[model samples]
Structure formats: C-alpha cells, structure tokens
Target: MSSADDPKTARQPQPPSHAMVGTWRLVSYDVEVASTGERFPAMGERPTGYTIFSGEGRVWFMLTGDGRQPGDSDRDRAQLLETLIAYSGRYRIEGDVWVTAVDVAWNPAWVGTEQRRQFALDGDRLQVRTPWRVMPNWADKGETRSIITFERAVEG
Candidate 1:
C-alpha cells in the first residue's frame, strides 16, 4: 500500500477543545507594561512557569523567577517572593473563556485576587489574555504589564 493508503496518517483528528487539558510548561511569554505597552529591556527571551488544566473544570498555574524582587528592608518584597512562586488558582472554562479564582498565591497579600484568563488553544499554541499588571506582591512597587503564552510541553 502507498503512504496515503496507510491508516495512521488518515486517523489524525481535527482541532478539539478538550485537547488542551493537561500539564503544559512555559514555552514563551511576552511581558510589557500593562497600561503603557513598555517592554522590559532585560526580558529579552525567557518565560517562567507551568500551567495545569483539567477538562473536569480545574486549573493550577504557577509563574515565577523574574529576578527583579526589591530588597528586603525597604521592601519585604524580596523575602515574600523568595518564599513563593507567582500565582496558582482554581479555574474553569466556559465556552472559550477561562476564569480563575486565586485559591493560593505565594504572597498572602493576593490570596483573594480574582482573575479572568481568556484562552485559545490550537494544536501546540496556547494563549491566555488578562488585563492586570503582575503585582508581584501586595505592595507592588507599581503596575507592570504581563501576559503569558505557552506551547505544548513534550512528555513521554
């Protein structure tokens, strides 16, 4: 039989919504000043985090290791950051929207922060959209633009 006559290649399924539910590592992310679109000079090409999605209506995402936490004295920010990762919360999907109720965060300051993350996943590309700066801590120095994009993490 010819290659086209084989059944393997012909069995590939089209895009499916539930295909996105799984553990996905950070592929790449774009960070800019949320309100001004100002990009960080040092944020050249490094993204930090892992996201867990469950088709049964659950999500756990953690983003960390930016290397920009303030000093401990004037700002206890560094200590706080040193102790915990970005944020992880419970999430659910409705149609094409992914909403999160921040159940746990590194900093207790953000324990109650609720967020809405819009997502679109096709093949290996996964994108999440938000409208808030990454307030690293409760006493964020200021607002900083942040968005996270990821691709499928290969696993055996």
Candidate 2:
C-alpha cells in the first residue's frame, strides 16, 4: 500500500479532547526561568509521574521526585510534601490548550483553581507546558515556565 494509504500514515491528528483521553507516563519535567533562560528540573532529572485523561472529562495527575525514602520525622514529611504534586478534577480542551479545573489537590491552595497548559501531541508522546508564572513556593525566584513530557502508557 502507498504510504498515504497506510493506516498508520493516514491517521489524522485527533482533536485534543479525543487525543488526550488516555494514561500517560512522565518522561521529563523541567522549568525555564524567563529572565535568565536558565532551565532546571521541576521535580528531578529523573522525575516520575502519571497523567490520566478520561473520555468523561475527568483528569488525574501526580508526580514526584526520585530517591524518596519513608521517614517519620516532621522534616521528612515536609520534604516529602515538597517533592510531590497531585491533583484531580474535570478538564477541557480549548484550541491547543488544556484547562484543568482542580477539584482537589495535595496543596490546598490549588483547590478550586483553574490550571492551564499548552499541549502538543506527536504520535505516542505528549508535551504540556505552563505559561510563565511565579513558582508557588519560591515567588522570589522569578517567573518560570514548566514543560512536562509524557508517553502514552501501554496496556498490559
């Protein structure tokens, strides 16, 4: 068959609303400072995370840094909390952007807030990015843009 007629090659890009409905595994997460062009890992060089988009308009996401060990001390608990992010809520796709209305979040401050991310899809990979915003816990650090990439999870 001609390449243009092949199923894989012929598949057109789906709308974000349909294209995003699946489980995705985190590949990388980074942040770039607007002022200096300096880029750093939002979590770590090897962060771990999952993002799930349902056809029913529900979304769930979680992410954490690597090398975490259980600790009973308050310091450890604080460290743990600092290294993790999680939230769940309804989502909608508008143009090329995905907006999430947070119903619940690990950080209480995020609850009831609408988070927006620009998205791009290429085959099995998806990249979502945040517009420049002051890092929540580090407002003095200046504005930052978060970039996160994910690969569609394979069903077992």
Candidate 3:
C-alpha cells in the first residue's frame, strides 16, 4: 500500500512553512485609522518605519522621519530614529486565510491589544491591506480614519 492510500496522506500539503519568516520590505500597504468618523490619512503615514521580521516569529519596528524630510543635526535625528518594538508570536495558514497570532508587544501596555495584518507579496514588493478601520489614540488625539499603501524598500 502507498502513503497516498493512508487517511493522513490525503491532507493537502500545508503552505510552505518558511513563508512568514524573513526581512520583508514594506512594499505597499493601505491602512485606516480611527477618529471622529472623519476622513484622515492611513496608518504608517505620520511616520515612516521599517518592519524587521524574522522566521522565528519575531517582529521589530523602527521609524525615522515623518515623511516630510530629514532635518539637520544628523546626531539628534539618528538618536530618535530607532525603537526596539520587539514582539513574539506565531503565524500559520488556516484554510485560505493567513492567521497571525500576536502574543507579545514591545510596549507592555499594548500586550493585550492584538492586531492582525492581512497582506500579500509579489516579487520584491509586498502589499499589506486591511479592511478594518483603526484610530491612533496618541496621534491626532485618536481622530483619524484612512487606508494607505506601503511600498517595499530596495535593500542596499
């Protein structure tokens, strides 16, 4: 008898296991922030940041500018250009959906608030899109709602 005849062998091959791990550049993404139900810019617009991802189910996000332009004082700017927003979690495929489980957050305060980023990739460009509306309580006094695109950055 062949393995194909076994019941377990009938299961479809799981999506490549190493899919979610890697230094994926933010190619493009559309995000929406919450507010007083008024129109506003999408998330990742206020400040540009890079998401450092790993295969070990880890994520670290760091920002530099506010999309305006770099200021003088290279030293001061560099000083404020980084943050260790480290987190750990697991992700896998559930039928046709890519389920993401966020278990940890850099900011302990956000430990309980979980977020899911539904995204897809093409070549070197990655596009992350969300249907849910979000609001930044810190920025704009939490008055913003929008969907934006994030483009993948070319690695040097």
Candidate lDDT scores, in order, read 0.63, 0.89, 0.47
What is the lDDT, from 0 to 100, of the residue 46 in candidate 2? 91
lDDT of 1 by residue, 1-156 (tens): 886787996674332257667888876555556556665422335646788776655667776555546565855765545533466666656687776677786667767777776778878878776655555532243565445677888889
Count backbone clashes in candidate 3: 20
> Which 10 successive residues of model 2 have the least lDDT summed?
9-18
Choose 2 or 3, whichever is better by lDDT. Answer: 2
How does residue 60 of candidate 1 score in lDDT?
A: 73
Model 2, position 45: C-alpha lDDT score: 86
Q: Kindly list the per-residue Cα lDDT of model 2 for residues 64-151, writing each as its tens digit.
A: 9877889799988888998898999888898889899999999999999999999999999999999888977657779988899999
| Candidate 3 deviant stretches above 4 angstroms | 1-20, 27-46, 63-88, 95-100, 134-156
Best by TM-score: 2
Candidate 1 runs further than 4 Å off: 1-17, 34-36, 41-44, 66-85, 132-144
Off by over 4 Å in 2: 1-17, 138-140
| Residue 153 miss distance in model 1 (angstroms) | 1.3
**Tens-digit lDDT track of model 3 for 1-156:** 788897787784443454444554432223344544444333343545566455544555443334544547887555443322345555554443444456676556656555555555555554554444434443644533323234555577
